[model samples]
Target chain A: MRAPDLIRFARDAAAGNPLRTVLLVLAMSIGVASVVVLTALGDGARRYVVNEFSSLGTNLVIVLPGKSQTGGFNPGNAITNTPRDLTIDDAQALLRASAVRRVAPLAVGTSEISVGGKLREVMVAGTTAQYIDVRRLPLAQGRFLAEGDWRRGASEAVIGAKIRDELFGANPALGQLVRIGDRRFRIIGIMASTGQGLGMNTDELVLVPVSLAQAMFNSNTLFRVLVEANSRESIELAKSQATAILKARHEGEEDVTVITQDAVLATFDRLLGTLTLAVAGIAAISLAVAGILVMNVMLVSVTQRTSEIGLLKALGATGGTIRTAFLTEAAMLSLAGAVLGFLLGHAGAAIIRQLYPVYPAYPPDWAAIAGLGTALVTGILFGVLPARRAARLDPVESLAKR
Target chain B: MMNEPLIALSGVERVFQLGDSEVHALHQLDLRIDSGEYVAVMGPSGSGKSTLLNLLGLLDRPNAGTYRLEGRDVTTLSPEEQARVRSERIGFVFQSFHLVPRLTAAENIALPMVLAGTAPSERRKRVDQALKDYGLTNRAGHRPNELSGGQRQRVAIARATIMQPAVILADEPTGNLDRATGEEVMRLLEELNGKGVTLIVVTHDAALGARAQRQLRMEDGELRQDSRQCAPRT
Candidate 1:
């Protein structure tokens, strides 16, 4: 038969039974929609983490004072204690590496800050003037600490946006004296509001010079070191150079961990990428269930339409033609369902994007195409049994039924 | 000189197995039908008249037979080859009219031509002519349920002859209609036969059988009598 005629026949047959067709299409569409929406969520999480890390700094490397016993760096290792202290001398030694552009030695401690009869416990981060440039932090008011002697402590502090708001309210806080722990320092700068990074809210921090913070905390050990590579291509070179320098400074012991920004992003990327594939596989089970539903409904249709099959055969339709006609009907229903599912999944993803607003919950292109392709293939594969049965039916017996 | 037969069958046997017991539906049947002949097969129930009609229509395969159509050994042809021959040379009309209830009258009439892959324009032309010839022009868009009994029968006949087959096999063609509608349907079949299309009608109605130019009576899965009559002018 002509292709148009065959399609018309299949369409009419499907249209003849509205409820069955709708139910079949609904099942298939639900299967496809679940695959798309779930994968969107999985991939969305991966992208969110990657964006968060990229915002910290590009071509950046972090140095923690502890040796991570595990080979790879885990985020949890940031809190572990080390066998040796990483001081300002270790931070300065990293600059000798050809690939290392700058280094900021960080001494973090919690202290009570009292300003104009207002006292609040805040996180204190101590580093050099280069800390601003290396961490890509912006200042909201006044100037940061000047480049001065690393050994002689400076009595100057930079308050975070939240501290300035809380302590000084609407009044100017720059050039005001704030007492931190047992010492008083003049507030030289106020930092812009950076919601949160790593585990600390930068908006709630108080920045001081490294030597002063080390004195206030009664320790000469540094908590972390932030390193910036000269170029993107030099990140790996900078990481190894810092490791070698730190090992030499710590008496031939590699007592500190250096991790590149790319390594962390890649770990999260691979972890979440696998998770997306796993969820997609689970969602594909629904398609198989939908395939079974198609097979069951088609079997019933074959039984119900036996006389029609017989009539077509009596009109000189071959077995292959009958099979093709039934399969065409299946493909049409599946394709319609897949299109409906595509729209529904995109709408669902859009809703998620709107709800979170931070993450772009768009399903991957390959996932959408694979969902549709699998739906079609599964529909046709399941259609074979019923179609073959229809083709093999005895025309004499089938026509007698009517 | 004798004209070559359009259909010939010899030593035809059809057996149906019912739980290890074989029942012979047709046994040692021999028959020949020429083009343009109007033949009626008449028998009581269980005498296998329907079975014989099905075999002649190629809807069923005989277990042992040498069946030839247009000098071709159709009994040995593959299933696909048989379907091609059926589409090109054979047509069937059933007792129930068997009009696809979902389709319009025009689509029903064009079904055979569509199966034969006839060009759409030619199919349209032929369907239009069939509708006009069957006196169903006004009802071309109506479905089977919307049509009257005689109209449905006319549509079935139109569909059967749409491919312009050499033979038309109809089994109890008017079984569901009133006597007047049945007579009208039979007249239509006779008119087609008069135009040189071979027509075979299977019926238990002796009066209807008498109207055909040739009649075969069956009993006990065997042909009991074959009779020929002169053409009756209506």
Candidate 2:
């Protein structure tokens, strides 16, 4: 039969069974929608992780005294009770490597810092002036601490956007006195808002020179190091060289952990990719079930229209024609369902945007195409047996039945 | 009898298995029909009238027989070949009319041409003539449900005759119609016969049977009698 005639046949058949058509379309559409929405969510999470990593500066690597079981540089993994030691000496040795450009030894604590009567318990980071270069934060006010701050042990402080708000209430000028814990310091500058990075607010911290923080708190040991590569090209080399230097400094004991930005981002990438496949697998099960639904519907349709099949055969319609007519109905049902499902999937992604801190990402074009294609192919594949049964029905016996 | 018969069945036997018993629907029946002959098959309900008609129409195959259409052995033809023969040489009208309900009158009439891959222009020309000849031009756009029983039967007749086949087998074509409508349909079939189309009617109505120039009577699956009502005009 010609294309237009077959289409008309499909349209008439579907019109004849509106309730079945609607139900089958709805079922297949839901399968497509679930696939699209799931893939979009996975894409959204990937973007979220990338944005968070970019906020911390792409070339920076975070160093830990040792690895925690979680594989991150958590401060709670200190070796106070153990005899094994990893220290500021390792950070200095890593800095001496040719591939390394700049490094910041950060000592962080959540403590009370006061300016006049206003006091806030905020995160305090102790590092050097290069910490600003390694990170992308720029000074919005007075100058940050020079080498003098670390060498002379000057009590100088730089508060982030959120900390400056709570302490100084906006105008954080160069020459303001602030007390951090037990010692007094000068609020030299305010860092621009870096927004939320790595699932935490960077804008809510106060940063000070490492020596000043150590002197003020009466501690001689350095904190965990933040190492920076010379450029994007040297990142992997820098990571390896730094790991080697830290390894040598610890008498070849690989206690200190060196984690690059690439490694962290890639973990999330692999995790998200696998998660997407898992979700697709789950949706495939639903698609299989929907295909079975199509098979069942087609079987019932064939049984109910037995005499019509007989009549069509009697009318000199080829077996191929009869089979194609029924299969066309199934394919049209699934194709319509796929289109509706794609629309609903976009709506579902919009809902995800409202629920998440990050905006949901659009699913790739292939997702939509594959979603619809799968539905169409599945309908044809599953509708074949029933269509063949219809085509092969014995006209004499069929007419004799009723 | 010098002109060759359009259809011939020799020793045609049809058997069916009914659970544990074998029933013979047509028993060694021999029959011949010629072009332009109007014949009626009359029998009781279980007398194999429809079976003989079905075999002649190429809708069924005999268990043990030699059936020929236009001197060719049609009983040995493949099903597809038989379908081709039916499409080209025979037309059928059923008791229920068998008009596809979803199709319009014109579509139902055009279906045979469509199946045969007739050119659109030619189908249009022939369908227009069939519609006009059957007095169905006004009801061309109506579905089977929208048309009366008689109108639907007219559409069915138009469909059957659109190919202008040599033979038309009608299985009780007026069975569902009122007497007036039945007579009108019978007249149409007789008119086709007048135009040289071999017409075969299967009916239980003796009155309808009496209109045929020849009548074949059956009882208990056997051909009981064959009589000429009058000499068929050459």
Candidate 3:
């Protein structure tokens, strides 16, 4: 028969049993939709984490005060040897590198603060003027500490939004004098309300000059040095140059670990990519189950239509023709189910995005295509047994029944 | 071409396995049918009438025989070749009026042509003409369930003749209808025979057999008698 006629005939046969057709399509569609939704969730989680990391800063390189080495760095030596301290001088010397744009020497310590009559413990972060630019911290009011020599002490402090709201309430906080660790300092600025990052919440922080924070804490060592490269391409260069500069400052000992932001981002990206594939594979199992459903339904259909098969055979239809017709019916039903599932999956993803606006819940194109291809292949593969059974039916026997 | 019979079966034997025992359905049966002959095969149940009809329709093969159709030794043809011959030269009508329940009467009538790969435009035209000729034009869109017994039988007949086959093998074609409807269906088959299409009807009804030009009586898996009327009853 011609292709169009064959297709129409199969379509008519499928439509004849409305309940069976709907059930089969529903099964197949559910399989496909689950794959789409789960893959979207997996990819969405990856995107969310990547976006959070991107929010930290662009082209950033972080330097931590440790010789935490992998692969033959000698764990015994790391535990026994006291690593050289990362100080403001090492942070200053990094400015000489061509790829380095800005550097901030961070010093963190806990101190009790007394403002008016209120007293509370607050996290104190001490850094230079470039700290605002490197960490991308926003100021709600007033200016940051004056730019000057890194060793000179400044009595100005910047309080976070939570600190302002807690200690000053309706009263203005900027320019007010606050006593922190037995030293009175004027509030220079109030930081904007930024949510949590890594573990620290910027909304409750108090920023001060590096020298004053060192003096108050009685420490010369820095917590972490945040370095910003000039551009994306210069991130690796900035990392290597900062490490080299820090090693020279520490008497040629490579004790600091300089990590580029892209390295961390790439690691997360690969981990999440594998996770998305794993979930998609799990979802594909449902498709195989749906294919088995198709096989079972088709087997029942063959038995139900035995007389019709006999009639066709009596009307001069070859066994091959009958097989083609049945196979065509199976394929048409599968294609319809696949299309429905594709739509349902996208709709499910859309609903996810609607509920969680920050998540980019879109199924990857490859996953969608693979899901469709697998559904089709599985449907046709399972269809073979029933089609062959229909083709091999004994016409005389079939026609003899009823 | 003028001397050769349309169908010639000789020494044909058909066996059925009933448990561990073998029952011969047909034993060395020999028969010949000519073009345009209206032959009735009448026998009681288990007398091999349906088995003979099935063999004539190529739905089953003889255990040991050479069956020739239009001078071709069709018994030796491959299954595919036999199917092609069946499609082009043979048509069948069943007692149950086996019209597909899902299709409209028109689609059912066009089924043979569809299976034979007939062009859509030609299939449509021919199906339309058959529907009109069978007095089913108004019921073209009706499904088998919506059709009366006589109407469904007419649709089956239309489907049988759509391919314009040379031979029509009918197995108790009027058995499912009332007396009045049965007579009408017999007349339709007679009319087709008058138009030079060979008609072979298998039945147990004696009255129906009397209307045919030739009647073959079978007993104990063998032909007991073959008789031709001088003037067949119209």
Candidate 3 docks with a DockQ of 0.75
The collision pairs in model 2 are none
- Candidate 1, residue B34: Cα displacement in angstroms equals 0.6
- Cα lDDT tens digits, model 3, B24-120, are 8998999999988999999999999999988988889999998999999998888778888888899899999999998999999999999889998
Q: For residues A191-302, what per-residue lDDT tens digits would candidate 3 score against the true structure?
A: 8887655545678888889999998999989999989999999998998899888877876678889998899999999999999999999999999999999999999999
lDDT of 2 by residue, B1-234 (tens): 457678888999999889999999999988888877899999999999988887887778899989977888999987777777877788888888887777789988988777666777898899889888988888889989999989988988888898888889998999999999998998888888888899999999999999889999999899999998776554
The total number of steric clashes, by the backbone 3 Å criterion, in model 2 comes to 0
Worst 10 residues of 1 chain A by lDDT: A73-82
Work out the TM-score per prediction. Answer: 0.89, 0.84, 0.88
lDDT at position A196, candidate 2: 64
State the C-alpha RMSD over the true interface residues for candidate 1, after superposing those residues. Answer: 0.9
lDDT of 1 by residue, B55-85 (tens): 8888889999888888778888887888888
State interface RMSD in Å for all models: 0.9, 1.9, 0.8
Q: Across residues A195-280, which tens digit of lDDT does each residue of candidate 2 receive?
A: 66774466887888876666655665555787889888898889888878876776555566778888888888888877776776
DockQ for all candidate structures vs. native: 0.70, 0.39, 0.75
Query: What ranges in model 2 sit over 4 Å off?
Result: A38-55, A66-105, A128-158, A168-177, A182-196, A209-211, A217-222, A228-234, A247-255, A357-374, A400-402, B1-4, B113-129, B229-234
lDDT of 3: 0.90
Candidate 1 lDDT tens digits, A1-402:
889989998999999999999999999999999999999999898888887887777789999987767465534346653467888988988989999998888999999999878999999988898888887888998988789777776799998999999999999998999999999999999999977566666799999999999999999899989999999999999999999998888766777889999999999999999999999999999999998998999999999999999988889999999999999998888888888888899899999999988886989898999899989999999999998999889888998987
CA error at residue A263 for candidate 2, angstroms: 3.3
